[model samples]
Target: MTLGREDQPGAQGSSIQDGERDSPSAAIPRLETGIPRLDYILKGGFLRNGTYAVMGPPGSGKTILGNQLCFERVRRSSSARCVYVTLLVESHAKMIRHLSGMKWFDTGMIPDRIYYISGYTALRDQGLSGLIDLLRRTLRERRGTEVLVIDGLESVEQRAPDVLAFREFVHEIQGLSALSDCTTFLLSSTGERSHSENTLVDGVIELTDQLIGLRAVRELTVHKFRGGDYLRGKHEVEIQSSGMVIHPRTEIQFDTPQASATEDRKRMSFGIASFDAMIEGGLLSGSATALLGAPGIGKTLLGLSFLVEGAKQGEEGIYFGFYEPPPRLCEKARKVGIDLDTYIQEGTIRLLWQPPLEHMLDSLAEQLLELLRHRPKPRRRLFIDGIEGFRAASVYLDRLPRFLSAFTNQLRMLDVTTLVSEELDLFTPLIKMPSPELGNVVENVVLLRYVELRSQIHRLISIMKMRESHYDRSIREFFIGEQGIEVADSFRSAEQILSGQARLLAGLQDREGES
Candidate 1:
């Protein structure tokens, strides 16, 4: 029998053993994550004594996230000492008060193990020597210190006198972390600022806020992590009274190994009997469906229909109107035979006005979180009107996709069937196409148009795409009425149904025969 090069009979086993030792699985180590969902993202946790950078915009919870990690070490008793060095505005007592509000400060035991020292002195003095002296004293005590959190590295930059000193100070701090044998978390508020700290750290986490209209949807991106394999992409996260919580996104793939054969367990009906029948017994629960149309169409009315159905089913519903205020929408729904008063009075429906567009993404996500927190039974339906209202309100367009993905996934996880409406009358047909950000996330899309026949414009409804379901391609004639929406037969002509013109196919055939 012929043997390969590595498998020769005389070859020593040491070389073959070395190949197995270098495999990917062998490199993985079990780690303890200081933060809750953070461990899940770290593929266990950070390596011991590694430096990590946490960055975000102002009021984006960077300080709170760092505090949670510092307190976590205290709880585990892995460290007899944990230090928090802050240079931002708040004093030590005020900072402790805020951390206490999160319930992170249990009054019982181990409070003494946690320490907070003001870094303003070193920052104001503009000397690395003062900072080094403070660090040496803290580290020399040797009380089994395990974690150290440094907040507002930018403050040091302000007083370092020059860029060279600032860079040098950061380098020394990295060296200090290694000498102390404690994992250090450095916080920075980085937007347009130029800082080399991102390169100096062992790991870097960049926080981004995407504005949908006026909403700042916060996301975390792990830019670099040495000696670890982590998820790449912007991830949704929220800061609550409980501290930092990660809203992870699950990309449902049928081709993957764990795809379940059974569909989701929950199901809910859209209120319209005819429409529900058209959709084969209404939309599945925890899935997303988009209703697209020009203004004056029944998109909002359809959203209310689902809410009414949810109310009847004893399930909760939230109606967020971006274009229409709640009072006006409720009044209109009343005229259309959907007495929202009944649902509101019964605590079955929640009507919320569109939040400021500057933080539209954040507001929408926070609304869902609020509902989940207050209503533990789970919401059955969510109706978002004027999703495109955010376009005019958004400062950045690229951020919309990540925001929508986060919002849709949250709804799906809650087992809520979401109905989203997009207003199409504002732009011309060519420019008004659904941006790719929204086109791919939703499961079903329904298009409503104003079609002209015989010189009279009539409303039409067409199923654009229905994921995993069969839908009729023909556009059905529809109307807004006192009894809500009504669907009619499809237009029989073929010249141009949606445009302001159409010619009868039968009439054209007859004319050709005569010619």
Candidate 2:
């Protein structure tokens, strides 16, 4: 009798299968893991009836990932059963107690749709052969088991006398999974796998906990997937009470498409009329504008005004800040005659605040992407109050440029007019940017500085760069008052406004002398 399609080698239709011609409809059927982002990374989901290895060190979320998968499966299909065989001496009660904390864990499905069995006693008594026999008998008794998860494969490896014995044990489970059409998961603490063990599995997912300075970061990498194209890199993984959440690296999440044929030529206001005139009507739509200045130079206030203006125009705005909390920011806005609380209450604005410290760059990117994903309309205004905050959070300083480039490109693709504020050194006369490469990423640069004129401190704003747009280059005097940020005429009387100490121009000095 000819074997059915399901009985063929690589029954899940992995692309690695030799000489197998699968129809388009029969090509790599997938079973969703009930994880939205993980499903996206897997190109839909894991191949049905395929054996995969979830390899990671202890406390690296190996057990949680396995249990989450099992619970998700049983939750969807009441009749579908998952056999969870624990090979380690860890108590089943202890495992259940831990899983109970996750939101996805369902106590009603226990013992009915999901069965937990102990293989430790059997493996301890009769060795590798006994463990294999136990799995075979369990499969035979529990007919129609859709999923089989063997937790603690390292325990079985410990019992095996040699490498060959361990290989035999893996082969037995592989054969059992194929015969029963059961999707199998083998959990191992160590990332190391023998040649046979690696070749026998259809895919391998590795989880790691890395210490980058004082921060401990959790990352997940798809080391191998025989028939699938996964986002290849160290993607960020966060283990929360909800479950294991994976944040695919921003650099690889979306492909940068060619420039759109329909360009947005509309300009947006800065809410300060004179400031808008300096920037030539205002910033162009979808352009990235950098607000470069020292601390307390009205950078945050300008960003707030930008958001308030967008909110007034019925556009949605987001403020991703690191310095001040939401309430403090709202209070500050009120002091400047901008009502931020009203916009926030009306659902036109969102404030996301992360304290200044060592933060995972991927985590921040994920948070921003999550907010973008849930919004009903496209975000019109985005105020990243602290670009330097992201720079400080990055463990690898060299990668910051690439991250920013990807991030800015994504913002442009979404048609978001972005304002990123960078804190410059107050004492330094020479202008310093967070990164020199940033000049290439942004389309505009607005410089705010404190200039000393005859011992009196004054504030000035200038348009340093505006790509493909016309703007006033003259340094204009600005002030912060009860009406918020107000810009006046350029400091035409001074010669060294950019020097941080303005002196009278020779012509102006001569005119004053004549007077």
Candidate 3:
């Protein structure tokens, strides 16, 4: 690690005071990690001159995460330099080869801006002293070294004579980082190591790649961050071709909305006059409505109608679904007298169909919010075909309600009027919501159910709940035909309509008894 370089700012003998914790106020500066949403969760980024531990299982992506931060440091700033010292047996060439496939990896920056070295030889021969000496020399040799990553901290800990010796080594590393004003990341596997290294560090980032059922979900959490604030909890992480992406918990990310909807004072339509009349005009602008019903009961169609009508009124809209492909979705909409393809071609409407596969809940919500944020027009309409798709993809079932609440709040803040379809049991005598919290969180809920009367199945539509507004409470028979979705007169001829069976009301029953 010897490069007979000229004098650098922190070349082992800097004039800056040792053990300088960041300033007391929020004015404490940050060293940006350049990872999307990660910085946001970090409340800015890592504290300047902070030492953090990145711990996880062997295949939990800790290695890639360290490398990504190193490369990003150099790419984001010209004067930034990084040293990646691995104490593992893996050769530097193999690591570089693996990283080359990632979009951000740059070979040209190696050895110059970013230096990779093997610290195993020194650690094995000279023990802790030898490793510390090598790191000091690397910092002195590489001018402008703002970032240093010590990968495979476990190897060094294994070589430590005892926990006391390992704690001393950890203290030495922290001192070096603090004195030199360089952010340091110590990478190691997560477990009950017999070392007090965690207490000596400025922060701890723990990653977990757990197999829940058949799905492998990766999550990240920050256990400790000194002199800095961050969103606490397990955030979803994914390793893609572009590199590592951390999706902060949706509920936490948008706990408070960015902006409010402009249509709060007015109403919007669904292109069906009778249905609009049923809702007293349309749903309140920028409100979320749960369109609940059983399968094959026109939930998706009705949600699409909401977006289609918005598009027709010169409002931008999106049909974000997971069950159908875009072509099939457009075709289905057209079959029900909706010119969905035309609106899509005109750019007034978009069909975003994500296949029903393993998906990160935060990632799905992030994408939808991103699209809504960049729309060309305000008061945009969004219809999620079935939220059950998200529920199926969720690794944590209990998080859906809160996640949906935050997500819905975010949509409203973006001035987007969203309609999410929720499926009930195929047949049931009781009216129940799969997510009871959803009914209370959203501003409105429209119930669509199937009723069997005289050997016929009739589709019924009614507004179950509406807040801050008035709506027709009568349950009406809705039909989807060439004339489009139409809501006719109420179910005046039957009782117990919601029980999946139609029965004669008291008056009619009395007449039958008399006969």
Compute each candidate's TM-score over C-alphas: 0.65, 0.90, 0.91
The lDDT of each candidate is 0.65, 0.78, 0.80
Error of 2 at 160 (Å): 1.5
Tell me which residue pairs clash in candidate 3: none
**Candidate 2 runs further than 4 Å off:** 1-26, 193-196, 506-515
Candidate 2 lDDT over 73-151, as tens digits, reads 7666666788899988789888888777667776777776788899999999999888889999999988989889999
The top-ranked prediction according to lDDT is 3
Better of 1 and 3 by TM-score: 3
Worst 10 residues of 1 by lDDT: 1-10
RMSD of 3: 6.9
Q: How many angstroms is residue 209 displaced in model 2 relative to the true structure, after the best TM-score fit?
A: 1.4
Residue 512 alpha-carbon offset, candidate 2, angstroms: 16
